[model samples]
Target chain A: MPNCRTVVPFSGTPEQEQKLREVIARYKGTQGPLMPILHEAQDIYGYLPEEVQATISEELDIPLAEIYGVSTFYSRFSLNPKGEVKVSVCLGTACYVKGAADVLAEVEAQLGCKAGSVTSDGKFSIDADRCVGACGLAPIMIVNGDVYGHMTVDRVAGILDSYRGEVE
Target chain B: MSENMINLKIDGVSVEVPAGSTVLQAALAAGVRIPTLCYMKDANELGSCRICVVEIKGGRGLAAACVYPAADGMEVFTNTEKVRASRRQTLELILSNHRMECPTCERNGDCELRRLAADMGIDSIRYEVEDLEPQLDESAPHLVRDNSKCILCRRCVAVCRKNQQVGVISAADRGFATHIESAFGRGLGEVSCVYCGQCVAACPTGALTLKRSIDAVRAAIDDPSKHVVVVPAPAVRVGLGDRFGMPVGESVQGKMVAALRRLGFDKVFDVDWAADVTIMEEGTELVGRIKAGEKMPMFTSCCPGWIKYMEHYHADMLDNLSSCRSPQQMMGGLVKTYYAEREGIAPEDIVVVSIMPCTAKKFEVSREEQRLENGCMPVDYSLTTRELSDMIAGAGIMFGLLPDEAFDPVLGDSTGAAVIFGASGGVMEAALRTAAVVLAGDDADVPLVFEDVRGMEGVKEAEYEVGGVKLRTCTVSGLANAEKVIRAMEAGEAAYDFIEVMACPGGCVNGAGQPMHSPFERMMTDVKGERAAGLYALDDSMPRRRSHENPEVKALYAEYLGEPCGHKAHHILHTEYVPRDTYNV
Candidate 1:
């Protein structure tokens, strides 16, 4: 796929780097530690930045190319920073047939960012999920924890509005 | 006959292969041909391309012969109508995404995909897809990546990761969008790539290719003001003939020189002379270290790829690397300095072009340190064996019919030790031939042939006593083997006084720039070994077998450079290395 996700600048703290080193040390020699370590790293930094990947590669002696390959193959792994308010539009066959593309377009227009990328302000991000196991709720739009089913082009802004300008 | 053997029927022919043999192996043993795309013998058997599919009697579906195991009493039909259709459909699907401009491709005549398509009677791509915008990555000095032509066979990826242990490229994304890329899609120059060109060698299509220096060399030759000189690496002699359809091991040294002379070179020198010079300097360094009992394990510095690898990955061991410049650069240094001064020509006016059986030499000649004291680079241009052949073809020269010719005077003559430098364990052997004599005071009984370290093995180790001093040495080709030796040294599990590391497996004879061989040819014969044998035979036939005994090199030292590793020689023939950040980002 063309890399549509804009590269979010690395703003990780020294504490995060230290925590990652400790986690890598813990799982250094264990079996198949890449996935678990990457999981914990994503939890710590909310993304897999080049700096983080370089650290993991050096610590584990694994090629960064392989790590990046794995990071890009799975959908759960993000190479960019997560937005303060996560917005997901299910683009599964059931939902896509129900005008989910229009709903996704509306969200992109409102957030000023394409799917798989964070907003410039870091307040919102749009993700086109394959399936959230909510085909019954065709054309579903989920913002944070609230699932807005039977979503339309007009409802995208309202759903995204509830989480906008809110401090974490 | 053997307990581990299994019997199977392939294309109605009874075959007996090992129990764990794949269907592909069974078919080959049964004299049946099963076409494959992504299968590269032991290196890669991914079976991602279903072109090698075959039908099994009483089986549910057709299975990929490359990955399918051959069971006892199994009946396989490789030419079934269903299997043929599946192979054709798979080829068509693969061709759909590929940009089909084969006329201008480097692999036009030898592309595996095109050959397969033609074999299967596929006249056209039935399911052509819209071509994606072409991604051309020419960021590195040695090679280029044209993603538009990549078939995603992963042969390059497999070679890079498994054989070289420099996993710089891998498959990224999923399905239709999947493509091979370096980490985070950075250019190869931005990563820790040694630029060995193994990827280009492994690639079955024109997706990867050598960054050509033929045009630049031609430009220099065409410039009347520039006095262009050419030198072919030792391996180039053995490797060049393959490009012209000669046998793999055929040595075309004399004809190669004739071709170069015909191409309008002011002088056609030899890198072998420089190799002899390298032994003088590197051997001195090794002996000095051994006598002082410091930096016990000294690594050979002849390979540019190995040097870059050491600079990027094993920076801690930088002290252990020999400070001698590679033979190519040494030849360049001498041509621009010694030859220029002797002939009353300006160093700036002399353009030294080296024809090498390697891509890394292209990068090597461009190093800032490779520049001479007069601010002129030793080698102006470095072209690969393939590029040399292309130049000869472009000039309309019938290479096979060319007359044998001799190299020019002064720096052209070399010894047998220098000629053998084309093979994997050759540098060590060459150095030993000279160093043993020096250590034993030139009168002691020292064996000339160190047979223990001679072969195509990944790693070879031997111990010998010279001048009553026990010397432990290790020779390794392929970076993966080098890594194992280094890791062992770091863990205190192994120790050595001298080490030779060549990045390409089987050394320059099988260098990435040598020639493109069909996958079938590569699997059926030991091409590298045959080329190495040619070098060994040439070495055996030479009048002088020791580097120290080279009359021309002796004259060079006596007249110009003075002593081995002396003040003047060190200044011109040696260089230093600095650690580089693995990821440029």
Candidate 2:
């Protein structure tokens, strides 16, 4: 029954602390407002780390368990930090039937990381996804939210190269 | 009839529909069927199919009529030249990498893709079909996955991850070669999947299908040396009628039993009998633990999906699960051991077949630990509701002409309470029926119905003051809700004296192994709810609705077993869950 203030202590720059306070004020005394605040914070900061979750929990006077529950419940929210470039591979049924496995393998090899893992250099974060509904363009990959259609194993390196030059 | 309505023009025809209706609804009201593949009503509206695209005047581009809202003064064209071309092209693109073996496919005539192509008059593919070899994943016992015919509509993924809350398979790679795969490309059997088969129900194509056990059952029947016995699950009575084009919730128990007899089975029994026995065993276990103050929250073990979830993710809590095998498994064990001895048949010669409403029953039948005597698996084959329907049709039996008959006297009699086990919260209610009687010491007939734990809510809870002792109980349907309940319990946010969990929402009636329906079509009717009502109504009409009233179950105790928790009953009807870390990723 302990509140979020008991779980998280105040630890951030004065400006960052003020920004957290402003975010908390927007959702103060509102029903189920923690999810929306977390969403907005993740939208601004690219991810919801433990520190950020704790800060939000303390500011909103909610339990950290409740905050963690909200984050894990929804598919849109992610806990880990995302790299500058987000690489998402399509694993929709159509693409899977068409050989998305090869595309995934090639991308994993080139990036030197598995799906749902971020690159050591912090340049790219790779992840596989459910259908984005572009089955007509089977074996599709999306990098930084830009859809790449009809991808092949040979074409994955080029797609990664294009993102490498542009990202960071 | 004085409600306000909206008038809209679709494909040059004027139609009137409700104000909040979508353009798809408006068009349907005009008798204009807009072609669609991935727009199953409220179940799936991801608009991933792109086949329902219709040209809307003043709109940016072709819009999916299913999800796009209908506004006043809007002009909609259902089958414009551009619309037809776009739909045809989209289908052609889907076919480019698809395996076109429609003649031999299971869903040959009933397939949505084939029907759409025929409706669109697509005779040949314009693009070169990719040479991506098809993958036939037979790792799971109850379901088969063929990725070649997949269109990636993601209806299956949406239902599994969002609706069922079991993330077994997901979209894995990006563009042109994108495919749905199990986590880390591991076999589905290795994952924490409940095997609820919601993905099978959500799939629009033949990619996901119930693994038919008909051949194995048929082989058993044909073998003169084997005595094949059949046990029909509680939900099968209500669902089997749908295969005969009967209205949702029709009780076809008589027909099902008669059909099994005609199919050359030596004996046709009811899982309901074992369900009663399960209540006896599980109910006693609950009381013993409660009396001894051991394992405060005893979870129901009838649901194979929930058991698999515990085995994979929550292995540490395995001891908390009720040690009763599902009614299907219980029936199988009894038929092979007790019945085999009584009938003078060798244990190996007695083949037990279960006709179930779930796909997960297949996994339960073949579980390594399920073998009872001399390493012999109790249930030989588990046929899904759909597979059973196919077998009935394959035998050329005139179902409509068949008279409704009763199940055999031995193990065939069941109570109305046992029948409700097909739907969500059923196990909890069934257990409560016997628990109340046992707690009263001489069976209290008062308060037969536990209304709090009934309904379609994801999670439900109630406190029962039975015999002056407060018992906190919780029931969760759907794996996601179960996860929430477990997390709450682990975090000390919630406490329950007992819990019942089913992986599929609405229980076996809405199982993954049931028939697949378009979401748009389901939006037009309350199919799942109606099916559930059918089971509940059947329960109400039965004269023997309490588990303890089952004469066969009483005989089970008198003949073979001394008491519910007797050593003999525990050896056969009960088992344990094992922890596994098979998530390769």
Candidate 3:
């Protein structure tokens, strides 16, 4: 394996640099330590791409398989870069029974993007999860951090329209 | 009393629980039974089942009490009007897509979902029922998958992937159309699933159920011309009582035999009889192979899950597997061949039924190689411990009130060592019992119980000094642990003289044929682990547990088979494996 070093100067504030250093130092000297650091980094930066995975893998001397395994094992970890706004629909049993299927279809139709895929404009990404434990609020959707419960097919376009407007 | 206790208030009740406790645990500690469908303690906590949603003050929405961390000075209301209304609505919605055939469902009485619905007073579902059709995938011999019954709790997925480490099934598709499916929508039998039935045990509802052979067995029993024989597996003795509400680990072997008799079987025999026969054959094979230097570390061939896994992943190591039939198959073969000749009955006239703690044995019984005797499969029907209990109940036989009876002579008697095979590492221990005695040239007075290889631990290893020879042995119960053991062996990190592997955790007591529950309390501290402990206790109490001491086995070798690895034994007992695609592509 060839060792390549590329130094990228940081222009963040001292506090930000200290936080990054603290996160990096937590995974030092452990076997296959890159995943934990990458997870923490993603917690700070939102999503990890190939560049982030490679940087952490190089720093921790862990194999790609080990990092990939950890990343894939956890539901929270995202490999592909996500858009600025995240739209998650709850496909819980309640939501499913309450016609979340049509709601999801409407969201997909309006955004022109499948769940777990980013929109063409890169403004939003849609992801479907098992449950957020809010089954009482059936057919629920979360945009950015605000949850929209009791969602309908007509409501989906309006929900995404608000995000598009905010981004603009 | 000062061991880092955390005080939390649940529904106005101030409860003190140990720190690091989840809000669910605290509520449970305070005698609040928060209804949940997908929160089996330790086994699964994926929060896929939203039935246990509770109102946490200032917390984000309703939280799944099973996984959410309970903080100090937290106000948690488990059963407020808001919580009850929400839970009722959630239950109603879940029922909208679910098949409400509880009257005819196998898990009707014991189902967690049914119990929860009744407890929550959900008399009817107000939502419009969807046109969701139940997919009854019955291609596998051991189990059936009904997608309509599934709540998508991911309990089955978690147990399959994390516990068993066999990723044959997972949540496929997305949104409301999402369903748990085998890879590429292939049948489970087509996938590299070992048929251990751990997924069945983990499922909260009627989504996964054992493929029952009770009807077949009943038909055979009713056949006037056929002599129906029952072979109870090693672990069945310990768990047969759980179906009757008997305390876990209580030996219901006698009652099991009685039940079989009541169910109109001609003979009720012990599978342990053949387990002893297996030890004799496998133990002797190991010795001969070791002496000839043909193959070292001969694997036990009893667990069908381990056998199937080896057939799929380690085909090259097939030579290392002992060519000995499992006790179930051995007994089946013996009943059809040796016993048939003695009774002056045709082999076709004998209906061999095996009652086992494993669902994998259902697949094992149906295997083509198992038909070595008279061109017929040795075991005609393989029923699970739960199935046997149901049959007993169906017959209206008073299990507890019935007198304790003995197994019929010739095949009913089994040694104490054979009983342990019901748990993980039991096969290795049973083999060691015979192997060590044979290696010592005579049955020595040394303790036969290999304590190191016993327990609920995922993996156990022990090195024994037997008559100047150091024999390294290892036992792994769960599939994930089995994967770890195989990886270790491949990496040369661990070397063993023998290895025993079972596909389910805590062995056959937790097999797919066992009870299914979600939001299952901690097995160790709850009812499930108690049943497992019951199995271990039965093994400890049995007298003459060693396989060599079974008179039936001794007589079979003396009258029919010359020795353990004789030509007659080899022709009838041993089997081979076939390779499978791991990726299911």
Candidate 4:
């Protein structure tokens, strides 16, 4: 968990909170609705804060233990907030063999953050993916849902700078 | 619904079991033994451990006999070379990762994993352990969790979730990184745990165990300045003998008192005396609630686990809980007060040690309300039957060879109703024995044996008319069932005059701190029923079967307490409940 001093206070609006509650209300009595509720919760809030999790726990009458367990199990769920420009580098078998590790390292260096960490300004974040199904574009990267195939270590700085400039 | 029986052959012997029964059940009926680690009869059927694997003809591979259902004319080979080899390999694999500190382990002799290894002739482990860092969670007062000895069988998880309805324990992380833990790196003490110790009982190894108080108890025993009086709950008599190699559910009452006397207790008293006293307070409260017609379904507050559960989860229904202290706590408080006054010993000089068939009593002793005005704990050291047995063995007392003896007089006299407090629905039955007379007249025509509340149903409900008042009652064992009934009551569905809840499935006899039943004992025998029979038999033979009829109890009220619900009784015998946080904040 990020320290309280560093974590941005929950600035989610009433509409967002209402939307989250509606998502929970829709799946109220469904057997094991935690997964779907969490999905919509992530959509409305962008990430799960302690308060959001607590709200779900109270609303669904489910133990926080079960909710936290399900949240931490899957890789898709993010407890931390996503950055304005999210970067993904595919580390699938083909890309890994094509030197995706070096590409990820260069990308991490440019962002000044490790994989799965958001930059302090909240403008950029880095993550390594298992497969983007772009093995033919072995050593691929994506920024803001736009694919940048056939990436290289030397080209990492300019690519990060381009997203950083755009977000700022 | 004709009794459907399916025939199968195991080890060349014909076996017939009810349809939908597992092959393990069929093999058991055929008198063939199959070793199991993760299987706890009705509670756990995960079959994660492959120790119970058996060769099924024409099957793809050796099937886990615990989960595989028996089919007509199916041939099962339990002890063939291939089956034995597979079972042996599974044991060896478990042994490779398990910390083999058997000699010094808490469950050295009784551990199922160690026993299976020996039975399968696992001479050596061929694989190396990864040396996972052991996390010893002694944060809770009653239980300790050691990851070193855990085999990851998930039996503790099942018991906590399925039986207790408290899923604080779950598989965290995955695979080699996986272990049973509370939510978000919290200790059991940090969660809403009632410290019932059911998971400790369900554990096959030393991974989970009672946080032993043997050394502290021994120090108190050795100090001549301290007067350490010992009280044994009635359930201990039926359970203690099993540790001494006697038959399960055998009442060793006289022998147990003798054993305690030999262990150097200043006075060996009976908690049954206090149990009788509990009936007086709880029964009066029930009658009072019925008279008021509020909090109609008065809940029995004897089981500390059930009490804490309600305090945490069902705070809204806290009014329904009886203000009476449990028999164990009542005994402790009275020993410090009334018994101290009678013997002319200063209350501070007396150290009350209780031998119980419960783990929750250890936590109950330290409950803030049970303490005295001087902040002295009423019960100084609450030891489990296992802990007491260990103490006896440590003191080199030959329990079986000792001659039978009687408890010390003043606090020892008890009626038969007191003894049955060890069984499920026993408190309700015991209270009814006295409540009938109190409600009607002295010679109220109430049946002695209430077969309605007898036996091991999860919840048993009954109604009777006493003095033209219809008494509706229900007895629930196991927290899951208790939760269900409480939820129903919240919905205005279940209405009754009295309700009893015991945290363990069959009450104190099946308590988590009691002896772990062997696989055969777990499968074939009604261990709960047998122990209950011993108490019921004592009730049948005793001169007085009702709590109110006990001459000693009458003398106690006359000499000290004055009356059942009097000020003195309320001060010493009653306690208030508090609403607790549902989650660790």
Best by DockQ: 1
Model 1: per-residue lDDT, tens digit, B200-315?
A: 98988889988997888888989999999999999999999988988888899999999999999999999999999999999999999988888768999999999999999889
Candidate 4 C-alpha lDDT tens digits along B1-585: 246978889988987789999999889889887888888888888888999999998898899999999998899999999998888888888877777677888999699887787888888777785565567998888999998789988888888888888777777555565667776567888888988999998888989989889899889989999999999998998888888998888899998999898888999999999999999988888888888887767899999999989988888888889999999888988888888888898999999999999999989998888787655778988999999989888889999998889888878989888999999988999998888888887654766777799778889999977666789899999999998898887799987888999999988998977777765567778888888888888888889888887777788899999988889898888889989887643
lDDT of 3 by residue, A43-111 (tens): 765554434544564566442323444554455665444568888888889999998878877887887
- Please, what is the whole-model Cα lDDT of each candidate in the order they appear? 0.89, 0.79, 0.77, 0.85
Candidate 3 residue spans exceeding 4 A from truth: A1-168, B1-3, B517-536
Model 3 pairs whose backbones collide: B39-B519, B40-B519, B248-B534, B249-B534, B249-B535, B415-B545, B416-B545, B417-B545
Q: Please tell me what DockQ candidate 1 reaches.
A: 0.55
lDDT of 1 by residue, A83-113 (tens): 8788888999999999999999888888777
Tens digit per residue, CA lDDT, model 2, B35-74: 7787766557777778889988888889998888886668
Q: Against the hidden reference, what TM-scores do the models get?
A: 0.94, 0.76, 0.78, 0.89
lDDT score, candidate 2:
0.79
Candidate 1 TM-score, true structure as reference:
0.94
- What is the lDDT for B382 in model 2? 88
Question: What lDDT is reached at residue A84 by model 2?
Answer: 86
Which docking class does model 2 fall in? incorrect
Give the runs in model 2 whose Cα sits over 4 Å from its true position.
A1-168, B1-22, B25-33, B41-43, B442-445
